[model samples]
Target: MDRSLRNLAVALVVGAMAPLFDSTIVSVALHSLAADLHAPVATIQWVSTGYLLALGVTVPVVGWLQRRVGGRRLWMAALVVFLVGSVLCSLAWSAPSLVAFRVLQGIGAGAMLPLLTTLLMQAAGGRDLGRLMAVVSLPTALGPILGPVVGGLILGAASWRWLFWVNVPFAVAGLLLAWYLIPADGPRTKARLDVVGLVLLSPAVVGLLYGLSGVGGSGGFSRTAVWLPIAVGVALLVAFTLWALRHRGAALVDVHLLRHRPLAASASLLFLTGASLYGAMLLLPLSFQELRGTDALGAGLLLVPQGVGALLSRTLAGRLNDRFGARVVAVVAFAVLGAATVPFALMGPGTPVWVVVVVLLVRGVGLGAVIIPLMAVGFVGLERDEIPHASIITRIAMQVGGAVGVAVLAVVLQRGVAAVGPVAGFQQSFWWAAGLTGASVLLSLVLPGRPRVAAPATPEEAREPVAA
Candidate 1:
């Protein structure tokens, strides 16, 4: 990529670090939040849940928003929203207020997530996509590695309020860089919003996320709180699918894009990869805490090897995707991920810490490798207009897949603990995660093999705001 594109990536990724880092940091501080705010853990859980639901509600609207206000303006505005929300969260006097502010933060985050990918992919114009995704995905790779460690250090030194305060620098730097570096808005389009599609899809995603989050507390899917909303979410999702199909290109997310083989395969594989990654995440810390008797910080430290491994593999994975194609890279990634997970399944409390660390390091490499291919492959043959929709679709697929994975694994872990014991329960959960990874390996075969070179965009196409 050129200097301009590189700068754009740097600006966007820097801004994105606030939300991504904020997520893992806040996760580590939940218990502290509960105690400090004098709220029940269940109530404090809303701090995360409310933000996630807001993200679900807002993510589907981004394509429309981007068309309305261009990527650059939309990005700055979202960053500002997140910045204000973070400050408000730091100042929060009560649990309800904190959760409310976090929802605001989520609104910003929801827009930023898809927009980040949309902007980068559009700027790159389908060239060097593998390399582009590696740079774009930096925050993701770092969040798991640095977020917890940073959170541990901050909480150890100061008040829980600093958690939100930490976001200010990233957000501010992102905004300043964005204003100076990102291209100005292009000519606006008058594309009409599909209100009907929005009405169906927004709630559909929120319901799915909320319902799935309830699984751990409800102790399986049998509870009304768990199944009822999920059923409604599924029903609405089906309705939106039918509506999107009928609406064709004008729909909120354009279900017709699934006709593209690369996107279709990528979307499907992303779902499974999401399941594999997030499912193990849910199980891993809990296993460390329960089996090894580590606290939250120690567990966080233990998982750093995985994140380091992932980080180390980013550039290499991008090169491999460009050279060998997503199929070869992904198949091997999933295989490695599955293999690494096996040690966890077999381990007892007596397993050496070094062994666990080594396995996580290898597992992180596999995890790192999985994202670049899945994220970039879908955009292989998409048009500029189609790129935004593809971004939304792939993002939603991974998100819903993550919720499903977390819910399913939580249920498995819960049941296994009841039926067998903690060690065995964790074993069962890890095995299930491995099984999902194995499935991903099989699905990887369907991805596009080795990318062909992209032609340069025409001057007129390059000047268009949407293309930019």
Candidate 2:
């Protein structure tokens, strides 16, 4: 809210844009990339899959990295790594090379994502979180609006290489701003890496994510590739949970934090949010292209109204969350989201464009309204030291939940198409997505209501200096 916290947010948001933009932008270019590199679509898919898996492996390790290195240094260092990865990706000549480079980029992103929340929450000293998250959500709001459109335009005008080149400006600008704007952190803690926990958790995340990723391509969860890794991931996750319970505060993730009711509820709701948001994303663009015969660019252009709706709702949603608390806002938001999604389920091949666009706008508003409260509530009563672990917990929940949503919907879409027709199949999937969102409305009832006035900053928080 104050000048220093605002500046820190600006710096982090600028840096965060690289990954957020990179993911969506690169997705639009996958077909172009497959053709350019002379690779099969299946092989080229790794360019995205490898990055996601690498990201999953690295996320659980970030809380440890931040404690060891300090936030400012860790953030800037991760930015540098991402910058380098971007440059390498631009030069990649083969599919394998590109996938490897993306893995490097993912490692940098995994650290930055959660660390961004940890730094801002720490600096705010538990004050004005709803307002701060609005600022934090800016690139998130902008990414959907801009990333696909920008990718489409770039591919139209230039070679696919320009896609990677686009990140150069954002990364460079982010680095320069961070150097002067972000307050330097104090001495680092001597927290030891939980090697055993990392061994269990990181692989568990990769297996789960990788396994889920295969479900759609392999036709169903019945395939060995689809189920084997997932089974292993689930088993390892159970082992890690037991391990973390024993270690308590010292574990890689601190599974103990789930005992905090607000956090527990927020984490669960966040999983549903991830499912609704990403599952729909996969469906929307494809629906336009497949059923409406829109090209990638046209489909992207048609989706702009949704992005605009999300952007418009963000600030107001934050204010409402601050005033009425997460419970009321989230319940209404999810209800709106579910309601908007229903029209899509009923849409026919002859459905009017204006009708679809209007629904998307309403859907986007629901999307924007739901995020602020869920993101902020988990930290409400947490101690400063606990913030990093909480960040890790929420981020992982969202990521894993997203994978699950996408995988399940993909399978559903495939079977629906096989059993019914194409148009009918898509309708079935939309119904499923709407149902998942409706479930979130019920879950939101448990979120904390009418937030208390922020407690006074601790002596340590007060003493932490910032630039005037």
Candidate 3:
């Protein structure tokens, strides 16, 4: 790889890993945090949920923020905020305080996740998008795999607060590297901030997420508390879409990007991938811990095979995407994922351990094939100007879809478990997960048949004045 590509890869990896680390690190420490803080499970759950909510709320603004402040400055600032939040979380005296700090950390984290990709891809000048996306996605693929294992080790050897503290080095290192390595922002452009659109979009996303979260909580969908916000949120989103279209080029999210076939298909596929991938994420661990009698650590450990599979396939998937096309890779991958999930549907408490591992390995491979290409293909046909909008929309889709998928799976698993035994409950959930994966496969069919490869930049083209 060229030196610039190597540096970009390092930056993307470091930035992406920070959030993934937090997602998993906290899971192991949640019990410890609750016990030490004298908090209930319901209350402690907010640490994760609050962070997610913060992520959802803040992510939509990233495009505007990038344009307003510039990517390098915004990225470094986000890291500092995350570092400070991590420290506050470590020093928290109460559960509520910890949850509050986590939200702050999440705001920073949410911005960084999409920004890193957008920035690096911009720097690459649209060359090697597939390979770059593969590297960037490694942290995402590894987070769940390493999260539990690392969380378990930290819990075993240290206090729960270390989970937050563990981020200190990575954050510091990322900040330093970003400051030095990331190019200074180009000439600042004068653009309207769309304050009115911000007002409409923020609450709409928050309300929608809040309503989805409520579905799995005490209030069912019928409760006014549940339906009211959801209804309002949907209405607000529709209003924002109309308002954005009226404003045309100045709209906050540039809803016009959706008209691009590659981006639209990519976002839709991401939603399905989120549903199938994360829905199963909820069910898989429950199956191990609740039915198979594995402890949290053991379940996390067993899930490593899937992570390994993803890791193993990252380079290959990227190469395949570049060679064949995202359509071929994604459709086949989703098919594999759908098929792999079927064995889990057949799972019982007495299922063999080796069988579960093999199934997860297959699922992991499918996951690898789906996510990398889906992400890369979204940028296809997008002008340099459109990358940021595409990034923000796709990221939001993935996060919201994950949230919705987990919520739906929670309800499904609860009803399934209640109707059948614990083991059977997981099986039913697995079947549902498989169905979602199959839907993703169908969506993959709609992806652009093949992407046109751009020729290597000639010196004239490279030296030509660029338009942002």
Best by lDDT: 1
For candidate 3, write residues 74-163 as lDDT tens digits: 988899999999999999999999999999999999889889878876777766766777888888777866787888888888889888
Between prediction 1 and prediction 2, the one with superior lDDT is: 1
Clashes of each: 0, 0, 0
* RMSD for each of the candidates: 3.6, 4.0, 3.8
- lDDT, model 1, position 25: 89
Candidate 1 local lDDT, 244-326, one digit each (tens): 99888689999887888788888999899878877888899889999999988898899999988999998999988888788
Per-residue error for 421 in candidate 1, Å, reads 0.7
Candidate 1 whole-model C-alpha lDDT, 0 to 1: 0.89
Which digits, one per residue and each the tens of the lDDT, describe model 2 over residues 339-370? 99999999987899999889989988988888
Alpha-carbon lDDT, every model? 0.89, 0.88, 0.81
| Sort order, lDDT high to low | 1, 2, 3
Window of ten residues with lowest summed lDDT in model 3: 459-468
Question: Where does candidate 2 stray beyond 4 Å?
Answer: 454-468
Error of 1 at 38 (Å): 1.2
Please, what's the RMSD in Å of model 2?
A: 4.0
